[model samples]
Target: MKIDARSVARILREPGALRVILLHGDDSGLIRERARLAATAIAPNLDDPFRVAVLDRDAADRLDEEIFALSLAGGRRVVWVRDGGDSLTAPLKASLARPSDTLVIVEAPGLASRARLRALAEAQADCAAIACYPEEGRALEASIRQMLAEEDIRIDPDALSWFAGLLGPNRAATRGEVEKLALYAGRGGQLSLDDVRMCIGDAAGVSLEDAAFAATAGDRAGADIAIERALAEGTSPIAVARSLLSHLHRLRRARIAMDGGQSRADAMRGLRPPVFFKRTDAFGQALSLWTAARLMEAAEQTQRLELECKQTGAPDLALCRRHIARLAATAMAGRRR
Candidate 1:
């Protein structure tokens, strides 16, 4: 059976009669977290050798033995498979065909919809497939509030909105940042806009945005520094490319609005989530230098940069630097003109 977002928490906590559960999605952190919830629900002491078994792709062949083995402690067992893929389809299918009390949890990040493993889990009456994707907009805001509330902290509305915009695309990263804020505020504390900025302004996502803004505003040195900081903080080169692409798309939208007779301020104001106040000038400068048509061309180049970075053995970091340098040069030339 396929699990919906609303039912995910309930199903993970009390998966009645569920033999095999597959958690797969773009958000690896969420998948792993949910898998832990399910595993611990079945076997509270995950370290108990007789009640739990953890396996990777290398030991996937032992799936049958683990699933069928009974717990010596006389409780439900959990077999956890990490980094799963289509390779486990046959083994999983065979295990699901039989009857067992043990719960098998498969954590497959980045699995496709048509994947055999996912399909098998969804088709089985005693199995479930859950998709874990990054939360956005209201969902993200709600999640942040929930996390803070757990620690008995409250956030101002303006601070919440600003903080959400600065968050990265990963759930685990977001949770870590929110936890850090909670600690800073202490229990029963309230957070202000300045509090969040002081706490999380230098996060990897912020640095990535800094690199994007600098590259499009003709600041080669600033772009280089921001990119270095983002990479050093464990941001992927692919993420950097996507950030640049997103900024160019935003610039294209603003340029189109300007060409349609809207003033610069109006176009910038029209942006969804609104441009961060601190970057307003840089964003406006980039908008001035880019025509809608030229921005589209640059977006296509960035799309290619992302694809190239995915290739085996590609010098991803060097490619990202070169691409940012090119954008900076283009912006400088446009300014000169």
Candidate 2:
């Protein structure tokens, strides 16, 4: 079965008949977090060596034989496969032929639509495929509130709205910021906008987003500073590249909508997951700067650079830096005309 984002939390809590689930998407952080949550739901004592068995990507062959064996600890057992790749496909197919009561969580990066493992899980009645894309709009807001509520921390409405704009779409980073703010606020303290700015600052993915947008918006100096800050703070080059790709895709869609007779403002408003409230105006500005053709060119260039970064001998960080700089320079030079 395939489940929507809204159904994720509920399904994790009451997984009914789901015996195996494949959590895969571009958002690796969210995928891992959900895998952890699913593991908790299935085997609360994750620390127990026997109750939960983790099979890493390289050791995937073991799962082929491991799944048929009963757990020594018994009761409830969980078999987790992390960073699943093509290597595990045959093993998984064989194991799924006979459904075991044990819950199996397969964590993988975005799978193609015709991916064999993804298809297998989705087709099985006792399985589910959940995509863990970045949280946005209502889902992002709900996640903030839920995380805060757990810590008994209260945030002012405006503060929440401010955070809504700055929070990283990555679940792990977003949760970390929430936890940091919770501790900063102490118990039962109401968090204010200033409190958030002072506490979280550019650390919670603001620099990364700012760097991507500033580059596209033709602000080279700003993008340079933001990019530097983001890298210094440990954001990965691939993460920055992915963010740029996502923004470019959105720009292309907005441009397409405008060409089809919709006003730019209307097109922006129609965006699903909706642009962040704080980013609406800036995104509108991006639409003016990047035509659909230009955005497509940029997307292709970035995609190639991303591939280069992932290749064996490349200096990923340097290549990523060059890509962002070139794009920013290109955007700025075009705008001057």
Candidate 3:
């Protein structure tokens, strides 16, 4: 059956009697996270190699062998398939024809409506297909709260709102940032907006906002330092790329509004997250520098870099940082012109 996003959390909490769970989404991080949660629900000891068996689509044909095989850890086995698509349809169908103690999870990219693999999972009994897309607005806020709660950390509402704006389109990235905040705040600590900013500090221990601000404001040196520090601290390249894209998009929107005769103050005021008070003048300058066409070009570059980061066997992190730095340099040149 097809599982709704709202129902996924409850089901994950108690996935009882389900045999096959297929998670397909554009949010690769969320897909992997849900798969991991489902696997752990079934096979508690994930560290036990015997209890967890991760396979590629090429191993689909051996599903029966893997699932039915007795676990060396002597409990339920988790048969996980990463990057699944149409190639595994036949093998999956054959394996699901019968049942066993193992819980099978197939993590796939966004599937088309007519995709047979998605259809098979939805149509079959004892199987479920979940669609995960980018979470935003309230959903993003809720997820942030939940993750923080788990770490026994509390966040101020303003800080939560600010942090939420900085995350999503990637659940793993969102989770990672939250984890860092928790670590910085120490156990059982309350997180203020300043704390949130400091924990997300840059190359010289400045915040992510500082880097994003510098890059967009055409400060190449500051952007380079921030990007380098963020990457060195284990921030994913895709995360940084996404943020840059968001920043550019915001600038584009504001610039477009101004072109349509809206006043600068009015344009910035209409932004959803609302530009921080201190940055209003700088944001206005970005509006002047980044034309609509220039914004589109920036977005395209950021997206391409994100794709590289997600590609298999790619040194995505370094590539992402380098691309962002180049973008920073380009912005600096644009300002000079």
Candidate 4:
């Protein structure tokens, strides 16, 4: 049967006799996490991961033979197939016929169009297929807010503005950046903007928030300096560009959610923390002056910069500095009007 992402936790708690699971998504974090959870749930008694047979998509077609003949000796056997060529192509309905002692975890990017896979999964009395896509609309935001609450992290209104502005489109990346902030708090048992700033602190004496602030505030020179510092300290230009893009994308998403009548409290609840608090003044300014179209244009620019950083080599740092600084400055200037 099909399992929705929201109900995954409950499903894990009571697996209900499914021996085969397919967890796939464009979002890497969610995919692997659910895959691991399923693997463990099936073999809750497993102490050694080696007993599990892992078959990559590239493995010879002998996979079926291997699986059929394989025994875990004493432990349970798990045949995990990734980048599923044969796994995705093989008759999925037929594949489910396996010993109860073994659980098969199949992970792919997204296979919604594959009618056979979908039908087989839906018809199965003992299998599940879950689709993991980028988090969106109200549900995603709520998850972000709830994750923080569960983590014991307190996010105030201003901080939420900054965080919601920088939240990633996917739970995996979103959770990853939050963990960085949590680690930044350093056992302090509390999360503040400074904790995020310090934890995300890179070679750029300027924090992720700073570049974001400069971008929204139109402070090109300030942005330039931040980019320069970040580069001098050994941070990759591509990395910085990607970070900026993620921040801007989050803001764009928030603006849409708000327009849809989602309350700021509800919106903030879904945002991950450490949004570079110092950038709130700047980001708020941009949010006020620019339409969603303008912000998305800026998002595109950051994406372009990422490509340039990857393809060009002509004093690449200078190229990055110029655009990033301009982007930062534009972001700040956006707030002006």
Candidate 5:
């Protein structure tokens, strides 16, 4: 059966036989947790989740052969495939059809509806698909409220918004931060924003979000510093640059669509995964700051910097420091014109 993230807790109730599950999202922790829960449901004992097998993309061929040949070791078997590509091998795709006694689970990053495995699963009578994504709106806010309620902690509504703004949309990050905050409060006391600031170590807030915000707002100085801080704090330059490029690209598309008379809401339609509401606002801010000329410059600069970071042996730390500084300075200057 096909299922959404909401049904994960319920679907995981399946305790035996072969199950093929596909789980994935930007949130690595939830993907892992769901996978673990599924496996545990089938085999409570780690020592002998009898005949349990996990296969990554690299081992699909071998795992396919193994599956084609194997039998249950006097107990239920589970074959898990994690970090899958957009499609699986033909043999593997065929296997997902007509669910077997051996459970099959697949985890893909952003596989589409047309993916071969997805096609196979949809066609199969016994198979199921479960879709997962970050929590949002009332759902996300309610989750925070529920977590606090369990801890006998009360929080201000604004603080919850603040917390959500900082944490992004990953369920795993939210759970981790909630756990940490609970530790600090010790099942008592009214939770305040200060407690959130003190205990929750989620990678939300002014790291990437700040850097992106600064860059978009033409705060050259802040952008430079924030970029450096973000990189030092383990943020990948490529990822940030990619984020920059992605939003810029979208802004360009959105702008053109708008010029052709499309509203922001309409322009964003059908965007894969859809742009987050905050991101749409940020994109607007960036468009206001960056003219086509400025974006061209920013894109070119980021591209060159990416090349240098990858190809040359110079101190990446220093190079990225200066490159980002210059990019920010250039962007900041654009708003003045």
Candidate 6:
């Protein structure tokens, strides 16, 4: 059967009579984490040779034998298939055809929806298929808070919002960064906005944010430098373009709020991912210079730029840089006026 997120914790903890569990998704970290939980539920000591079998793609030919073999220690066994795919589908189907106490855990990151292995797991009465994906918005924030709470670390609300915005979309990378932050804060420590900045401000996302803010604030030199650094740090041009577009969209919303008679400070404070304290001045400047109509035009152009970058053989880097430069120039002209 196919398991949803709501039942994932219970299924992993007490997978009663479940012969095979397939964990598949784009989020490799979540896939691995779930696979581990499912495996450990059957075989407490994953390193025990008699009770556990770890198979890579190359060693998948021995899967049937591993599944049928009885454990010498007299406990249930776990066969963990790493990098699983449709190639192992036949073997898995054959093994599931017979009765066995061994639990088979398949860790297949990037598995397609219609994959044969996934289909078998979902259709079989004694099997399950679980999809793992990255968390976003409130889900992402809740995960961050939960991870930090595990270490008894408290974070300010503003710090949590800013930190969530800065985190990458991947669950594993986000976990690693949060782990680093927890270590920095120590047990029972508190994290302020300044604490988060001191810990994670040098990340590539920060540079991208810098490029976006500088472009919108008419700081041509600063924007150029930040864009170059961000790309050099392995941030994609598409990501950079989206970052600027996101900033523009936020500015457009703030401008709308201003039109509704709200003060600039209120509008800025009302942003979902609250503006970082250090960028308040630049954000305010961008808000003052950009009217809703002009912001809308710039956003439309950015959408076009994103589409162009997605085309085959397009010079994405150059296009992104040129577009950012144009935005900076437009802001400069608005400032001059």
The top-ranked prediction according to TM-score is: 6
> Which of 4 and 6 is the better model by lDDT?
6
Model-by-model lDDT, in order?
A: 0.88, 0.80, 0.79, 0.62, 0.64, 0.87
Off by over 4 Å in 2: 202-223, 231-337
Q: Could you give me the TM-score of model 6 versus the true structure?
A: 0.86
Q: Provide the global lDDT of candidate 6 against the true structure.
A: 0.87
Residue-by-residue lDDT tens digits, candidate 3, 180-295: 88889887889987777768743222345566777777777877777777667555566677677777888888888988999989999998667877778778877766778888
Which sections of candidate 3 miss by over 4 Å? 203-337
Q: Assess the local accuracy of residue 211 in candidate 4 as a C-alpha lDDT between 0 and 100.
A: 62
Q: Please give, for residues 31-95, the per-residue lDDT of candidate 2 as tens digits.
A: 99889888888788898767788989898878866666677877667889989876777887788
The TM-scores of all predictions, comma-separated, are 0.77, 0.67, 0.68, 0.60, 0.58, 0.86
Query: Which scores greater on TM-score, model 2 or model 6?
Result: 6
RMSD of 4: 8.1
Winning model by lDDT: 1
lDDT of 1 by residue, 248-330 (tens): 98899999999999999999999865787889999999988878998999999999999999898999999998998999999
Q: Which ranges of candidate 1 are over 4 A from the true structure?
A: 112-115, 134-142, 156-158, 245-319
Residue-level lDDT tens digits of model 6 in 247-298: 8999999999999999999999999767877899999999888889999999
In model 5, what lDDT does residue 72 have?
Answer: 49
What's the best-to-worst order under TM-score? Answer: 6, 1, 3, 2, 4, 5
Better of 3 and 6 by lDDT: 6
lDDT of 3: 0.79
At residue 257, give the lDDT of candidate 3.
Answer: 91
Span of 10 residues, lowest total lDDT, candidate 5: 270-279
Residue pairs clashing in model 2 are none
Per-residue error for 286 in candidate 2, Å, reads 16
